[model samples]
Target chain A: MKELQDRIRIDGQVIGTQTLKVDSFLNHQIDPAFIMRMGETLADKFTQDGVTKILTVESSGIAVAMAAGLKLGVPVVFAKKKPAVTQDSETYLADVFSFTRKEAVQISVAAKFLVKDDVILIIDDFLAHGEALNGMVSIVRQSGAKLAGAGIVIEKRFQEGGKKLRAAGIRIETLAAIEYMEPGTIRFAQN
Target chain B: MKELQDRIRIDGQVIGTQTLKVDSFLNHQIDPAFIMRMGETLADKFTQDGVTKILTVESSGIAVAMAAGLKLGVPVVFAKKKPAVTQDSETYLADVFSFTRKEAVQISVAAKFLVKDDVILIIDDFLAHGEALNGMVSIVRQSGAKLAGAGIVIEKRFQEGGKKLRAAGIRIETLAAIEYMEPGTIRFAQN
Candidate 1:
C-alpha cells in the first residue's frame, strides 16, 4: 500500500482540485508488475472471505481484477457496459452514471455467472462517486450472492463516496486513499 | 496448446457455423489461472523477439494482455475504444469495424506509450476478421514501433483474417485455431 501511494505521488498528475490522472500506469498504459503487486495487496485483505468470484466493470478495471482473481484463485467477471439498454432475461443489469464521461451506461453480467452460493468481491481502479461500485453491488444483490467487500486501487477520500459506502456497512479496502488533491499536490489519508 | 484445444472443445459454445462463444473462460467471465497459462504459452513463442511492450484493445483483451505482459516482463498498453472520434493530437487512432456488433469503433493509444524503439507484440482474445488486430497494427505502425507479431488465443482458420495477416508477413501464434465449427462441434486446425 505504501508503494502504491509512493508510486501515485511520483507518477500521478493532479488536475485542478478534483481529477487525478493515473493513466500513465494504472489504466491506459499499465505497468504489469506493479499491477500484480497491487492486486496481491488487495487480495491479501480478503483472503479469508471465501470469495468465489471477483467482479469489476469493463475497460479500466479488467487488469486489476484479473490480477486479483489470479491471486485469489477465483473467476473474474467483468460487467459489460452498453450505451443503451437491451432487454435480456438471462442477464442482470444495472445502470451506472459516469461522472467523468457524463453518460449513462448499462452494465450487465450474465445470470449464470453469479448465484446465491457465491461470495463476490468487487474490485475497481478508482472509487470517486462510487457510481460503478454501487452498480456492481446492485448486480451482486440481484443474484442473491453474499458480498465479501470491495477492493479499490485508489479512493478519493475527499469525495463522499467512500464515506457513504462505508456507512452502508459495505467493507471497502483501498490501496491508496487520497485525502485531498490540488494542482500539483496530493495528500494520502493515514491508515 | 492441446489443453487449450481441449478446453475449447469442452466449454466453447458454437453459435451457427461461424461464431464461437468463449465468454465463459476467455472474455465475459475469466478463469484467471487458465488465462495465465495461455499468456505464458503466447509469451514463450516470442521470448526471443525482445518484446518491449504488449498491446491489446480494451475490455476483452485486457486480461490476456496483462497476463502476457507479466510473463514477458514488459508494459501492457490497451487501446481505448471510442464510439465516436475525438479530437486529440496526443493520441494515435485507427478505425476498426466490428463484424459482430456492426459498428465502427476508433481505437486509440496514447502517443507516449508506443515509440520507435519499442517492439510490440499484439495480443487479443479472438481473431475472426482481424479488424481489432489490424487497428492495433496500424497504431503500432503510426508510432513507428517494430512489431514482433501477434498472439491470438483463438483464430478462426476458416476466416480470411489469419491468412491475410500472415500473408502480409506478420507472424501469428495461435493457441487454438478452429478449422470449422457447427452448432455443437468444433474442429481445431492441425498444428
Candidate 2:
C-alpha cells in the first residue's frame, strides 16, 4: 500500500478536478510488477473470505482482476464494454454509466460464470462514481453469487463513489485513495 | 502448451462457423493460471528478442499482455478501442475494423509510453482476421518502435490472419492453432 501510494504520488496526473491520468504506468501502460503487487496485496486482504471469482469491467480492470485471480488461483470475469458476448445465452447483463464516454453502457458477464455458488470479488482500476463496482455487484446479485468485497487501484474520494459503496455495506479496499485534487495539487488519504 | 490445448479441447465452444466461444476460460471468464502459462510460454518464445514492451488492444487483450509483461519484467501498453485517451497530447492513433461489432474503431496509445527505442511484443487473445494485430502493428510502426513479433493465445489457421501476418514476416507464436472447425469438431494445427 505504501509503495502504491508513493508511486501514485509521483506518477498521478490530476486534470480538470476529476480526471487522474495514470496511463503512464497503472492502466493504459502497465507496470506488471507493481500491478501484481497491488493484486497480491488485495488477494492477501481477502484470502480467507472464500472468494471464488474475481470480476471487473473491461478495457482497464482486466489486468488487475486477472492479477488478483492469479494470486488467488481463481478465474476472472470482466464485464464487456461492447456487449458482444450476448449473441449467445452466456451472459448476465448490467447497465453502467460511462462517465468519460457520457453514455450508459451495458456491461455483462456470462451467466454460467457467476452462479449461486460463487463468491465474487469485484476489482477495478478507478473508483470515481462507483458506477462500475455497482454494475459488477448488480450482476453478482442477479446470479445469486455472494458479494465478497471490492478492490480498487485508485479511489477518488472527493467523488463520493467510495463513500457511497461503503455506506451500502460493501467491503472495499483501495491501494491509493485520493483525498483532494486541485489544478496542480493532489492529496492521498492517510490510512 | 499441452495444458492450453487440453483446456481448449474441453472448454472451447464453437459457434456457427468462425466464432469460437472461449469466454468460459480464455476471455470472458479467464483462468489466470492458464493464461499466464500461455504468457510465460510466449515470454519463453521471445526471450531472445529483447522485447522492451508488451502491446495489446484494450478489453480482453490486457490480461494476457500484462501476464507477459510480468514474466518479462516489463511494461504493457494497451491500445484503446474506445479512443477515450486521445483528449490530450499523449496519443498516437490508428484505425481498426471490428469484425464482431461490424464497425471501424479508432485505437490509440499514449505517445509517451512508446518511443523509437522500444522493441514491442504484441499479445492478444485470438487471431482470426488479424485486424486487431494489424492495428497494433500500425501503431508500433507509427511510433517507430521495432516490432519483435506477436504472441497469440489461439490462432484460427483456417482464417487468413496468421498466414498473412507470418507471410508479412511477423514472428508469431500461437499456443494453439486450430486447423479447422466444423459444427461437431475442432481440429488443432499439429504444431
Candidate 3:
C-alpha cells in the first residue's frame, strides 16, 4: 500500500478537482508488475472470503480485475457496457450512472456465468461516486451470489460513494484514499 | 496444447459455421486454472521475442493480455474502443473493423504508455479476419513500436486473418488453431 501511495504521488496526474488520471500505469497503459503486486494485495485481503468469482466493468477495470483474478485464482467476469440495445438473452442487467460521462447506461453479465450460491468479490481501479460498484452489486444480488465485499485500488474519500457503501454495512477496503487535490498538491487520508 | 484441445472439445460450443463460442472458459467466464496454463504456454512461445510490452484490445483480450503480462513481467497496454466521442488528448488512434459486429470503430491508446522504442507483443482471444490484429498493428506502427508478433489462443484457419499476418511477415503463434468445426466436433491444426 505504501508503494501504491508513492506511485500515486509520483505518477498520478491530478486532473481538475475530482479526477486523478493514472492511465500511465493503472487503467489504459497497465504496469504489469505493479498490477500484480496490487492483485496480491487484494488476494491477501480477500483470500479468506471464499470468493469464487471476481466481477468488474469493462475497459478500465479489466486489467486490475485480471490481476486480482489471477492471484485469487478465480474466474473474472466483466460486465460489458454496450451502447446499442442488445437483445436480452438471459443476462443479469443493471443500469449504472457514469459520473464521468454524466449518462446512465446499462451493464450486463450473462446469467450463465454468475450463479447462485457463489461468493463474488468485486474489484475496480477507482471508486469515486460508487455508481459502478452499485451496478455490480445489483448484478450480484440478482444472481443470488453472496457479496464478499468491494476492493478498490484508490478511493476518493471526498466522494459520497465510499461513504454510502460503508453506511449500508457493506465491507469496503481501499488501498489508497485521496483526501483532496489542488493545483500542485495532493493529500492522502490518515490511515 | 493438448489440454487446450481437450477443452475445446468438451466446453466449446460451435454456433453456426464459423463462430466457435468458448465463452464458457476462454472469454466470458474464464477458467482460472486453464487460463494460467495458457499464459504459461504463451510465455514459453514468446520467450525469445524479448517483448517489453503486451498489447491488446479491451473486453475479451484483457484476460489473456494480463496473463501474458504477468508471466513476462511487462506492462500491458490495451487499446480502448470508445462508443462515445472521447476527450481528445494526444492519444494514438486506430480504426478497427469488427467482423462480428460488421462495423468499423475507433480505438485509442494514450501516447505516453507506448513509446517509440518499445517492443510489443500483441495478445488476443481469437484471430479470425485479422481486422483486430490489423488495427492493433496500426496502433503499434503509429506508436513507432516494433511488433514482436502475436499470441492468439484460438485462430480460425478458415479465416484470412492468420494467413494475412503471416503473409505480411509477422510472427504468429496460436495455442490452438481450429482447421474445421462441425456440430459438436472441432479439429485442431496438426502441430
Candidate 4:
C-alpha cells in the first residue's frame, strides 16, 4: 500500500481540485507488475472470506480484477457497459453515473456467472462517488451471492463514497486514499 | 496451444457459423490463472523479439495484455475505445469497425506511452477481420515504434484478417486458430 501511495504521488497528475490522472500507470497505460502487487495486497485482505469470484466493471477495473483474481485463485467477471452480440440475454443489471464521463451507463453480468453459492469480492480502479461500486453491489445482491467486500485501488477520501458505503455496512479497502487535491498537490488520508 | 484449443472446444459457444463465444474464460468472465497460461504461451512465442511493450484495446483485451505484460516484464498500454476525461489530448488514433458490435469506433492511445524506441507487441482476445488489430498497428506506426508482431488468443482463420495481416508482413501467432465453426462444432486450422 505504501508503494502504491508513493507511486501515486510520483506519477499521478492532479487536474483542477478533483481529478487525478494516473493514466501513465493505472488507468490507461498500465504497469502490470505494479498492479499485480496492488492486487496481491487487495486479495490478501479477503483471502479468508472464501471468495468464489471477483467482480468488476470495465474498462479500468479489468486489469486490477484480473490480477486480484489470479492472486485469489478465483474467476474474474467484468460487467459490461453495453451488451455485446455474444452476451447472454439473462443478466443482472445496474445503472452507474460516471462523473468523469458525465454520463449514465448500465453495467451487467451474465446470470450464469454469479449464483447464490458464490461469494463475491468487488474490485475497481477508483472509488469516488461510489456509483460503480454500488452498482456492482446491487448486482451481487440480485444474484443472492454473499458479499466478501470491495477492494479498490484508489479512493477519494474527500468524497462521500467511501463514507456512505462504510455506513451501509459494506467493507471497503483501498490501497491509496486521497484526502484532497489541488492542481499540483495531493494529500493522503492519515489512518 | 493444445490446452487452449482443448479449452476452446470445451467452453466456447459457437453462434451460427461465424461467432464463437469464449466468454466463460476469455472475455466477459475471465479465468485469470488460465489466461496467465495463455499469456505465457503468447509471450513465449515472442520471447526473442525484445518486446518493450504490450499493446491492446480496453475491456476484453486488458486481462490478456496484463497477463502477457507480466510474463514479458514490460508495461502494457491499452487503447481506449473512447477517450476518458483523464486521457491525454495528444494521441494516435485509428478507426476500427467491429464485426460483433456492428458499429465503427475510434480507438486511441496516449502519445507518450508509445515512442520510437519502443518495440510493441499487440495482444488481443480475438482477431476476425483485423479491424482492431489494424487500428493498433496504425497507432504503433504513428508513434514510430518498431512492432515485434501480434499475439492473439484466437484467430478466425476462416476470415481474411489473418491472411491479410500475414500477407502484409506482420508476424502473427495465435493460440487457437479456428478454421470454421457451426452451431455446435469448431474446427481448428492445421499448421
Best by lDDT: 4
DockQ, computed on Cα atoms, for candidate 2: 0.80
The alpha-carbon lDDT assigned to residue A13 of candidate 4 equals: 87
Worst 10 residues of 2 chain A by lDDT: A81-90
Ranking by TM-score: 4, 1, 2, 3
Across B41-103, the per-residue lDDT of candidate 2 in tens digits comes to 888899999999999987778888888998898999988866663265768888888677788
Query: Which candidate number maximizes DockQ?
Result: 4
Question: How big is the RMSD of model 4?
Answer: 0.9
Candidate 3: list runs displaced more than 4 Å: A83-88, B83-88
Pairs of residues at least 3 apart in sequence or in different chains that clash in candidate 3? none
* DockQ of candidate 1 (2 decimals): 0.69
Q: What lDDT tens digits, residue by residue, belong to model 3 across residues B57-175?
A: 98788777877888888988888887433443778888888778778998888887788889999999899999988889988899998889899999989887999889999989899
DockQ of 4: 0.91
For residues A16-60, write the lDDT of model 3, one tens digit per residue.
Answer: 788787777887778877887887787789989999999888877
**Distance (Å) between predicted and true CA of A93, model 2?**
2.0
Indicate whether candidate 2 or candidate 4 has the larger TM-score: 4
Candidate 4: residue pairs that collide: none
Candidate 1 chain B: worst-modelled 10 consecutive residues by lDDT = B82-91
Which portions of model 4 show Cα errors greater than 4 Å?
none
Query: What is the per-residue lDDT of model 1 for residues B1-191, given as tens digits with 9 covering 90 to 100?
Result: 99889888888878788878787898889999999999989999999999999999987888888889999999999899863122235889999998878889988988988999999999999999989999999999999999999999999988879999899999999998999889878888886
In Å, residue B149's CA in model 1 sits off its true spot by: 0.2
lDDT score, candidate 4, position B80 = 91
Clashes of 3: 0
